[model samples]
Target: MDINNALKADPAPLGLAGFGLTTFLLSFVNAGILSGSAVNVVMPLAFAYGGFAQLLTGAFEMRRGNTFGFTAFTSYGSFWFFYAFLVIFNDLKIISIPGKALGIALILWGLFTLYMWSGTFRLNLALFLTFLFLWLAFIVLGFGSYYSIIELTRLGGIFGFLTAFFAVYTSFGIVNNSLKPGTIPLGPAILK
Candidate 1:
């Protein structure tokens, strides 16, 4: 049988799954947000969070022809790799520049995701919209922190959590849709 035939309608390949899964894992290692600045502190946190898991996920997502999977998994996976090698890049000794930079990047990416969110309804729609607006809102919050709006960063973290929650919840759709054999409403990910 063709490999494609075995899947349940373009469900994320293991790689894509791994990418999102690994990203989810990293959030735990970092201490009290980006409030601290120490290689000893940050590097270990990154190493624990960043590893081959993301690479595996990205490579598989690429094989599955998931542009979002490819882009997200690969980019974030690389971020961890680079994050680990701060020895050369020196990601520390800075005042949370990465957060502000991440905000900028996320804002740009959110614009694209918003476009994706506009696609015809499908099993993936909810996941995508949840991901899009949450990140867009998250970016705004992150940037706000740079301007001393600490509440913004807190709010950003909430959106970020929303992003994570949906990512995890969306995984359930794979199981639910597969079980239902053909029915799962579309666009709920944004709301639920």
Candidate 2:
């Protein structure tokens, strides 16, 4: 193998896994399958695995000149950090954020994800589906929080579960293919 290829590793799997697991845990709470107290369990996972690990993965992607990976991983990683801190500060009574304000933030994230979804057309189906569901989740959750609609929030949680599943599946496929090519399939890119 070339020195460069040997030195660099694929970071997508790590980033995806971190994002997926954390999302799954949080989604359970959002869906009301778990009580609010479950957030205490999710906070540290969000900070460490989803936030920090994905940040590291994004750095690796940057080193590999994968702009999409770098942007996606880093952005989501920062999202995790934001989420953890938001909950922490609220619990500590350090700061209180109105639901409407948080809703606006989520809507902004949805806007970002919608644009990012455009980039996914050149990628595999796994990534495309992941982004699609994520965008839907953000929009539904944003509106739900904004309007204080419980059903919408539950629906958003369902979307989050789908997003997490696809992300985790993509990560598994990539890792499996690395070990034994074609052992798993990530459907072809839509663009080419």
Candidate 3:
């Protein structure tokens, strides 16, 4: 699961898949982010899992030769890594500010991705709309007060489940050499 390793030797496609899967994993946390009252509640564990995974993945992403890979993985990784430090010690101030920060990030990422992908890919209207909803929803979710964003948080969690169950389970399984996802399998397995 070294994101920087570039397994297939094609970083763009593989890196994107990597980024997409990693992003998917974060959705569960994002769901938690949107549903839970404060970032502090989730920060303790989020830092280690999110931070270390990204740190390793980002390095491999760089090795994969993705210009977008390193920054995306590492920056997002660093966000969690530093936050882990703040969380373990009960520094609530950092948690207080991150919701808004994450919100802004969603807005920017959505905008950039929409504009970037809209014109390039032969994306169907349905696909385009899905992306639109996905990106805009988070951008708007960011607007919720950190304390009272249950519905919007639920929306984020829905996306998280979709992406996780559909998107990343296989890749992560490949990286880890285990089928710990239990009920969420991407396809029929050789074992079965």
Task: Give the whole-model CA lDDT for all candidates, comma-separated.
Answer: 0.52, 0.94, 0.50
Q: Candidate 2: which pairs clash?
A: none
Once model 3 is optimally superposed onto the true structure by TM-score, how far is the C-alpha of residue 45 displaced, in angstroms?
3.5
* Model 3 pairs whose backbones collide: 3-57, 3-60, 3-61, 4-59, 4-60, 4-61, 5-60
lDDT measured at residue 113 in model 2 versus the true structure, 0 to 100: 98
Q: Across residues 1-192, which tens digit of lDDT does each residue of candidate 2 receive?
A: 797885466889999999999999999998999998999999999999999999999999998989999999999999999999999999999999798999889999999999999999999999999999999999999999999899999999999999999999999999999999999899999898
Off by more than 4 A, model 3: 1-41, 82-102, 112-137, 146-149, 170-192
What value does the lDDT take at residue 29 in candidate 2? 92
The digit string of per-residue lDDT tens for model 3 on 1-192 reads 784353754322332244345445556555664443355545644555456666666787776675455665576567566545654554645344466665665566557646633532342332233344445545545554243466676676566455334324334434443324344333342221
- TM-scores of all predicted structures: 0.58, 0.96, 0.50
Better of 1 and 3 by TM-score: 1
Candidate 1 residue pairs that clash: 15-57, 126-189
Candidate 1, run of 10 with poorest lDDT: 23-32
Best model number under lDDT: 2
Per TM-score, the best of the predicted structures is 2
**Error in Å for residue 143 of model 2:** 0.4
